[model samples]
Target chain A: MPAVVIGLADDPDQLSQDLQSPYPILPVGALFSASERQHLSDQYTPVEFAAACKPRFLNAVFARYPTVETLLYADPNVLFLHSTQPILDRLRNQTLLLTPYLLQAPGDTGPGKKAWPDEKHLQNIGLYNADFLAFTRSTETTQLLSWWQSRAETRAYIDFCKGLCTDQIWLMHAPVFFGGITIVHDPSWHVALWNLPQRQLHQRETTWQLADNGQPVLFVNMKGLFNPDEGFFPHQTRLNPAKRPDVMALLQAYRQQVAAKELAALTAIRPAYGMKPLLPVVRGWRRTATTALTALNKWVDTIYLPALPR
Target chain B: MTLAFTICSINYLAQARTLGDSLRRTNPDYQYVIGLVDKLSTANLPADLVPDYPMLEVDKIGIPDFQAMCDRYDITELNTAVKPFFIDYFYKNRPEATAVIYFDPDIIVFQPLTELNKALETNSLILTPHTCSPTPDWERPNELHHLNTGVFNLGFIGLRTDKIARAFVDWWKERLVYECRIDLCEGLFVDQHWVNFAPAYYQNVCIDKYLGYNVAYWNLHERQFSQRPDGTWLINETDELRFFHYSGYNPFRPDDISKYQTRYTFSQRSDVKPLFDLYCRELLANANEQYTKYPCVYIKPPTIKRYQRVRKAIKLPINRLISLLQHR
Candidate 1:
């Protein structure tokens, strides 16, 4: 499979610098018009703007490589411990391949089965791991992508009440909405801290297995397991080092790989588009004011109204 | 077999009776048990104080030196501390019991616990958080208050007789026996705060976020009240009103919904007026006046003046500092 690294570059020189990487690098600004970019920026938060751009990114990828039948979108944080050949083989027949949270089931001491993201977490966030998703280009997939883009473009913030979380929560109902959607339950796929309680890691030589006899871990989602500035070996506060020392190597390797990328210089670059969150003090003041007003309204209704004559 | 129980001292017997009546009307099939945290006395010259349901005194639940436990804890703390002991008693002794559901004495059941029963089929421990949805901007008992007090409302809990359930009961009992105080600063709010970790540690734990499950003043901002064509109360328009928890409510002051919750009143939330009115009638009919007259055998009844004096004494220095800060 041909590798492609896509991102929006504010500076043309920065895009050239990124092009030095082995993978074919493409600037997102080249794909969309300035007007389209402005519209997207007006519609979502910085975090959400990046998510809403995925459908268009995939469309661009498909247009560039017309022979490419399937497109896999993995978050920058995910590390490929194994090849994507197996996932691609399955995607040949299926329109969509999504990873199940594997939270709804009861505990069973079996190979390649772990329940990290417990049922409560799934209920809170969503069922699908939007970090790792595969979509085979089809009429149904095209329509699904359009529907997802439409939702994400408008309502892609982290608000659960509005049923929005970038693009993840929207995919929760994707199985019902789109046909030929297969939920990949294999534990080797999308292994992260949420399911660590169940998915035991045993590394033999360089290969990581779920249990004594499990499939090779396709990828390890080191989403929050590293802090380049702090130089912490394992950044997950939830995971105890004394207990699961097996993950020490896995996390250490991930940290080294991320550091090797030497993308620290780009960290200070502010987003050219989308909303920045309000200052802490400003947000706190707004909350307090809203609360006080509400209380005043209720107090008037309870105390002042009772004395009123009919 | 399934058993439903509530833990309370003599003061809450009237409320327990009302709860029993609700269960009798709504879910008569389930065995109702009252875990009395205080000893009973027949000194009161009035109608029968006890309800028709079986009463299990806290002492009989096999807590070693039960009197000492009672002495250490105040009325509220004592009532809450004895819950795990009673739950363990039912699960250990009664092998026939498939599940045990607990409700606060103040909660009045409207609809059968069908959703809870359905949840228990798969889950070992089920809990309902104070508010499943976000509460609109309010002064007190907001999301932060719930965070400080507890995530789950221990007033309504369902536990299936399983390994994790039994483990939770043991763990909770250990915590409650020592630290079931209502001291928010100390990170203790009876048994409620400890169970916030239930979903974290235990397996097959289900958080039943059903709108109707435990409707109270705290969650009223999100769950709207309405009535069905058949006259059955509904929550959020669609959800059947399973139970209404009169947590801080007093039947004596029917106009004031709850002393603790200043969020709503009879004049403000007129929809819940009929429900509170029905509750008041039931409580009064259950001889609330006479029942409250009797004191718990374990401890002397506190006088209103003394209680106020003690509270003021505790708050005097804090109040002085606040005034000083304002003046500065």
Candidate 2:
């Protein structure tokens, strides 16, 4: 198999020097028109624009490597801990492969004990995690790629109120709209913060396995684990170092591996696209102040004004 | 054997009766029952006002927190919340019933459900999306609304009595116990939004795109109705109309298409006018006026309910503050 990194680069030489990796870089502007790039950048934040570029990247890959029978795309944060033979075998004859966020229902353990990434969270973000998608060369796959590209170009923005979470939520319609969709139910694939409560990780002699049934762990999505701002997924508060020492150990190892690379140089090189339209995130004191003001407004209307006059 | 049922309070008995009459005329082989959310004993209905179908009161299903559910939800929410419980009841009590289908009380059957029954034979669950194509305009209930509400409409769900179907119902029942509400901010719109996971979670689930399956106000953009010389209805001149869901139509406002929609009017879309006219006449003949007078025994008065909700809203901020301070 071959590997390539698709990114936005203002100075390709500087990017190549920063990342001393073997994988060649494919600029995002090479795939889309100038007008299309402007529309996407103006409409969405950097995170959403990156997500919307998935279909375009895949289309470029298929066009470049016409003889390549199957293609697998994984997010940069995902780390492989085991062999990919099993996953490749599963995608041998399938047109598209999708992995759900959770294979089992996050049960109500008790009052203080609650499940993270419950049905409500999944309903908002999406049913399938868009971090990993595998497709084989087929007519159905081509059709899906075209449909997804059209939707991603226009409607790729993070608005949970409108049930839009970048390009993820739109995959909910793929199984219904397209043909030959296989939902991978193996718990070992694409393990992440959203499903940690159900998947317990344990290290074996050489590879990692699920603690309960000893299923081999293929790869783990280190999405929010490495982000200093997010600190292990903002939505997840149920899991901590005290609760699961094994998960913490895994994160520690992943952090060490990332530290070994030229992380500072890579982080310094900013992308050339999607610089405007900042993400709508209210952090630190701003969040606290916003909450305080909302509470104060409600308090005055309900308590103070009611007790006054006439 | 197959069991088809609809859940409604007494106030909607006329609509329920009309639905039952349609099923009886179209598909007589199926057993039709009225799952009453209202207590007939408390209402003491006259003989003429009562429906002729077998009436099964909701309280008889033995929902453990039935009283608590009534306290928490209003009429529309309460009626929809108990849908899965009714399916579970028939699954356990009716041993001979191999398939169970649910239609909202406002829907009328137009043709024999031959395709539906055939699909349910092999598939564990059958679901119909709100519309196969995109909505024409940004009307009241468009694609965004569908996303906030749900992708698949729960007005009609067909389940074959099997393990996967049982698991789906069990999960749905648990979620609807407390989280079933119309709060758009919390990503909930009653029981409809939750079934968006049916196809994703369960096996052998069929996302049936048959334009004939669920024809309603939300899907009118893709479907246009026409009557054949043989008195059968056809959609888009190709697919036969299986059922028409009169979701928001009222007998009093017979001229309007549906109170929930603003995209089309009866005059603008003359094709669907005859269907609405037929439904209005049937509802009136079934004592829609007399049935509308009776109130549901479980629902509290509007003023008291509003006051309770207001009190909760008022306390929400204070409760949050206290919790915040305690955590700090």
The candidate maximizing TM-score is 2
Error of 1 at B79 (Å): 2.8
Q: How do the residues B1-328 of candidate 1 rate in per-residue lDDT, one tens digit apiece?
A: 7899998777778899899999999988889999986666543434466578888887787997776777787787887888889999999888888999999999999988877787887899988878765445645675446544666788989999998899888877766666777755434577776675664455567777678888888888877788988999988688988999988888888788788776776787888889888889989998888778767776646423323444455556555544344333
RMSD (CA, angstroms), candidate 1: 11.8
Best by DockQ: 2
Query: Model 2, A1-310: lDDT tens per residue?
Result: 5555554423365566445556667777788787877877776667778878888888888888889888888888888888788888999878889998877777753235475545776777778888898899999898888878877767777677777777788888777666677898888998887677778889877688999999889999887666734321464655564578878888888998998886876788766666665534455665566567667755544442333254
Steric clashes per prediction = 4, 0
Model 2 CAPRI rating: acceptable
Q: Worst ten-residue run, lDDT, model 2 chain A?
A: A299-308
For residue B149, give model 1's deviation from the true position in Å: 3.5
- Estimated TM-score per prediction? 0.60, 0.86
* Candidate 2 global CA lDDT score: 0.82
lDDT per residue (tens digit) for residues B1-328 in model 2: 9999999999999999999999999999999999999988889998888788999999999898799999988888999999999999999999899999999999999999998999999999999988876567778787678878888989999999999999999999988988888877567889999998886677688889998988999899889888899988999999999999998999898888889999998888999999989999999999999999988998876532224455567767766765554344
Model 1 spans > 4 angstroms off? A1-200, A204-206, A212-245, A263-310, B41-47, B64-75, B114-123, B175-189, B199-203, B226-230, B293-328
Model 1 accuracy (lDDT, Cα): 0.71
List the candidate 2 regions with Cα displacement exceeding 4 Å: A3-21, A33-36, A82-85, A92-95, A109-113, A228-232, A241-246, A270-272, A275-310, B226-229, B301-328
